[model samples]
Target: MQPAVVAHRGASAHAAEHTLAAYDLAIAQGADALECDVRLTRDGHLVCVHDRRVDRTTNAKGVVSTLSLAELSLLDYGGEIGVLTLDALLGLAADHGVPLFVETKHPVRYGGQVEARLVELLATRGLARPSTKEESPVVVMSFSTLAVRRVRALAPRLPTVLLLTQLWPTLRDGTLPPWADHTGPSVAMLRRDPEYVARAADHGHATYTWTVDDPADVELCAGIGVRWLATNAPAATRATLAR
Candidate 1:
């Protein structure tokens, strides 16, 4: 089967990253899954923002955690879809029957509270756990091992992804930590070692790659058997893979 096309930050190449407009457009374009980075605000709320600060995505300047959700809402994100929250995003995904890949930003002041809040939020929405890994619509991903483990501990039946930026022999041999159900490698790593896709599969691990926007990379990923293709151009990638 062709790889699932997961939208990274919601068709971010065409619209502001993490904006509702971008996500809506992505789903409309037939993206299979949505990926977002979430950060905890000062009030302990999880907001779907990639950066620690809002300076890049917004006109106003302030650390995301330093500002309250109400304060962030007033800032101009070029127009509508100001500071989208995880709760609102979950609702949108539920409405469309789409899956979400939630990345909890690490090295934050909140520490493990981020994962705790996520677990609580998911549980509140009746999605804390599923009967099986494949049945879960929400997937937790993180670069920090501790963060992913925290998610596993908080919600035993939930699926988690461990994002990899660097490649080593053990991982190249398809050895992943027990806590992670899937492995996320950067597009560069996949290009550097295409064998990793099949290798991961040998160990019963599905490989997901992030931010793949190039056509050649898309072909390479699909050709190498990547299970999930994360990209800023999901619609385009899906069409290319179909061909």
Candidate 2:
């Protein structure tokens, strides 16, 4: 099977990251899915953002949960890039016939607001129904297991992927790391230990790795049978996988 090419934060290379323009461009470039990082606004609205503070990505300074949606809307989320809300993103994905893989950025800080709102949004978009396979494709993912679990509880049919990094610790005595307790399994660990991937698959979860920029790394992930590949250079990653 062809590996699914997920545009990291949309076609972030060409357009402003996470903006409608970037997402549209990603679809135009033949991406299988679009990836987004979600955070909660002060007023409980879910917005697409990568950082805890908006300074890096937006023309604002402050925590995302501290600002209301109305206030956040005033700031340029893409900075010189373009800004797009979660709703706008989902709509665009639906219209263009692409799937959306949403990653919750700081679930502990935002509580369950992001997952709850995402579930609601997906349901409203008719994506919650398993009967319709092509209306709007969506999958909620996160480094936080709590966030992923919340999404699974709300929408069991929706596939969830666990993002991984190498820094996480192993479970020697059934004791998980502070971050691992919150996140599903680590994709990096999965690469290091095939048993980790087997355990995750046994639990019915898909695995995905993030920010993969190296061509060799992309090929390695494909060889491992990872379901999703989140990369900054989608075109390059896709090319590498094709090889």
Candidate 3:
């Protein structure tokens, strides 16, 4: 079976990252899930933003952790896309009946507060925890082990993904951190060690790979049985997988 095609930052290749436009396009394109990076605003609200600084994706400049939700609202994130709160993004996911892969950015001043706020928000939508992962509409992912642990602690039944940029010594033995529900590796790392997926599976951890835009990489991940294939162009990736 083809891996689920998740739109990384919501079809970010066609629209600006973290914008409603991108997510809407992703939903329209039949993306299996929408992915986003969540950061805490100064007032403790969760916003969909990849970078700590707003200079790249927005017209104005400020640190996301330093700005209030209202302060962020003034900026032009993209044409008609505007600033998107995790609340609004969640609504979009609910409306479209698609799942989400929410990544909490680490090393922020808010620290565990990021994960806390994420769990709180999920709880508000009755998504904090499900009886089983198959019933979950969202899954939390992070490169920080602490962040994943916090999520697991706050919501034990909530699914968590531990993202990998490099091979940690322990992972060489094919076991993920005890707290991680799944493993998310960068496409480059997966290319270097495709066998890690099988190894990880041997230990019962599913694999999710990010930023896979190339057709060859898509095929590679699909052929290797990646559970989720994150891409900037979900439509193209899905089409490639279809072929």
Worst 10 residues of 2 by lDDT: 173-182
Better of 1 and 3 by lDDT: 3
TM-score of every candidate: 0.98, 0.81, 0.98
Residues 46-112 of candidate 1: C-alpha lDDT, one tens digit per residue: 9998888898889888898889888888887757646899999999999999999999998998999
Name the better of 1 and 2 by lDDT.
1
**What's the CA RMSD of model 1 in angstroms?**
0.9
Regions of model 2 farther than 4 Å from truth: 78-82, 132-136, 166-191, 194-205
Q: Which runs in model 3 stand beyond 4 Å of their true positions? A: none
What lDDT does each candidate get? 0.90, 0.70, 0.91
lDDT of 2 by residue, 7-48 (tens): 999888777787777777788777888999888777777778
Per-residue CA lDDT of candidate 3, range 1-243, in tens? 789999999999998888888999998888999999999999989999999999988888989999999999888987654579999999999998999999999899989999988999999999997889877999999999999999989999988899989989978867987889899998998889889889999999989899899999999999898999999998899999999
